[model samples]
Target: MPWAHAGYADADALAWFAHCEQVRADGSGHEFGIFDAASGTLVGGCGLNQFNTVNGFYNLGYWVRESWQRRGAASAAVQALSRFAFDELRLGRVEIVVAEDNAPSLAVAERAGALRECLARNRLKLNGRFANAFVLSLVPGAPNTIGGPLSPNTALT
Candidate 1:
């Protein structure tokens, strides 16, 4: 969770969660925690955020626990969230923006069927500084299917 908590203090994290709850209640977007079904353990989180109403798309993000890395947890959660974005939310597209150097996250986006669009310059403000990011996208099509367990992962914004 270092990436997710990089710039935030405890209070900031708390405020972010509070805002997420409010957004969910208002139907602006959705946030979900990923869990292990058998053990009922929290592993990660995934969500649809940063709604672009004019473009009809949502930003998708997720991160797995250290122990859960390479276990397909993030991919599963992403697929579920993407499905929700297209089906329940009726959104046309979902974007996953990750730091260009973050290979693990880039792989997760690829596994979830996201297409790499471009490397945007100074696209994200991480911790305190700006960083480049790869903007991957998932649009409604024959290949963008959601069929996996619902789980959680760290998000970019």
Candidate 2:
């Protein structure tokens, strides 16, 4: 809900999928759909993007449907995606940036063991406006506070 608006259409979805595939093919990033394990419903999405390969890091982002809020969907996606970013891609850092006022996402970052690094100015462009954001990082070799490191194939609840 936070990342999307009400006017999304079928054409928009098609373009989005094409973009995701292109990103994967080009090695720029990987995006994944978060599905509910029990019923196979899409609950959210998470991805590792904005790669800084030279620095061994990627920017991680996620969003959950309003109906699925507080149900562990985003947390599970974060852990899974971070695992992939670190283990499969051999990246050293995963950065999660959240708008200063986005409490739910901020909580998800904290709950997933990301260390708060700083508050960055004009860090994000939300709905045509710039806003401050909290920068957090999840690094390998640190203790995972939520679920342990999960495989990318693992089903999210």
Candidate 3:
């Protein structure tokens, strides 16, 4: 994933975790690791970040490990995260921006029931270069049924 860090060092992981904590602490966003329910293995990560506070929306992002790709992992994560955003965070909108060439993420967004909003020009930075992106969005009370609604006390466990 272009959005992922290039290194795999322990220090890098620690820094990433610390950053996640800071994000949560500052009320900017929250990030979570995606784990396989049956095996309890880390498969990917997802988050709600880049708050547009005035607009009552957040940017939803996710990535799945290569082995877990094509098996509904990304879609499931998107559904759960969006539900959490809506129900728990009380946010009014969630946006998924996928690079124009990133077919996998675009598919995940569509399958998760996010409506495509636009093809934003130069909307993404990938490997130090800019790229156009497709913007998709999810709103409250939409027809999305995957994973159902998250309960009041429930989180992405």
Candidate 4:
């Protein structure tokens, strides 16, 4: 995942958790681990990372494990996060920026009802290289079933 820290060690992951705690404490963002409901196994993680308070929007991010790929876990995680951002945080929009060559992620965004807003050039720097990306967005009050109208309490497990 280009969006994620490359070659993250255990300490790096721990530091990330601490950062997430600080972000929550400072009211900057929210991050959560995605787990399988039935077995309670960690499948991935999803979060509202970058907050654009001026625009009332957030940058959404998620990644599923290789074993969980092709399943609906990514989509579900995104939907739950989107619901959290829109309903709980009361944010205006959630954006998913994906590399153009990443077909699976693009599909996930599309399946989550994100509208492709535009193509941004050299928008992402991954592994010391710049890459183009498609900016997909989901706005509140949009007529979409990606994140079904579940009660706030039911969105995340």
Candidate 5:
């Protein structure tokens, strides 16, 4: 996650993999390797994690590699994940915390119709100093579920 997001850690990585295993074992957490449907090459990645089954809340996060930023890859992946979250997982809410400066990422979240809720100032401790972050979400409504295979997709926007 550090390579894709930021920061690095020892136990965090281990714990994360372990979490992935646990979630996958029960058929919950998902890690999707993004690919170019045209070229069949692994272009990047996307998935939903930190899932909370009982409360029906989880996190949505992903990276599309530096090379595959535009092209609507992130939007496609997020739409798929969000559909899974709402349709399959039956989740009511999904949240995404994005670094404020990451316009590409923010754009991805926005394109997915996630609302910007707040400016979390000095909220994330990245390198000893707190970094500002944007709290965005897919809370059952917005516009632009415009590009994916989401069932009743038109009803959303």
Candidate 6:
């Protein structure tokens, strides 16, 4: 539904839902949601979008509630998700394009060991304006993790 608010409205979340199902059927995209363990709230989502199973590549993006910033929640979830992609899913790579000005998110990406590839100009449209972006990725052995749920107390800020 968030994708609807972001622009794919007429088809509703059904479009994205179908997309997820198709990818899961064929070995590409997979959607995931982040939750707060203690509070039991849907904090945000993270997923593989615009994916290619043969190439083992997908766009990784995540959003945590504004209230949850700096808690290491994003990094932890990404760590688990990345591991799942590489190990269980046998992915060769997972790429993420993040807004350059989002320092905290960039830090989280770095902490998760995603390598910065480039600074993309006006890559994402937000509030009707295109913003500069940073491209990063985690390939096999990059972060070299094994999938699991977020362990907040063990996370880094």
Best-performing candidate as measured by lDDT: 2
TM per candidate comes to 0.83, 0.89, 0.89, 0.87, 0.74, 0.74
Task: State the displacement of the C-alpha of residue 118, model 5, in Å, after optimal TM-score superposition.
Answer: 0.7
Better of 5 and 6 by lDDT: 6
**Candidate 4 overall Cα lDDT vs. reference?**
0.81
Give the alpha carbon lDDT tens digit for every residue of 38-154 in model 3: 667887889999988788788999987888778777777888888788879988789999999989899989988999989999999888999999999998887753456532322
After superposition, which runs of candidate 3 have C-alpha atoms over 4 Å from their true positions? 2-7, 144-157
Q: Order the candidates by TM-score, highest first.
A: 2, 3, 4, 1, 6, 5
Note the Cα lDDT for every prediction shown.
Answer: 0.81, 0.83, 0.82, 0.81, 0.72, 0.74
- Give lDDT for model 1: 0.81
Residue runs of model 2 more than 4 Å from their true location after superposition: 1-3, 144-157
| Residue 117 displacement in candidate 5 (angstroms) | 0.7
Output the TM-score of candidate 3: 0.89
* Model 4 segments more than 4 A misplaced: 2-9, 149-157
Alpha-carbon error at 55 in model 6, in Å?
Answer: 3.0
Tens digit per residue, CA lDDT, model 6, 65-156: 77776777788778877877777877888888888798878888888788888999998887688999999888886444334556754332
Q: For candidate 2, what is the lDDT?
A: 0.83
Q: Which pairs of residues have clashing backbones in candidate 3?
A: none
Residues 68-121 of candidate 2 have per-residue lDDT tens digits of: 888777888888888788779988788999999999899989988888999999
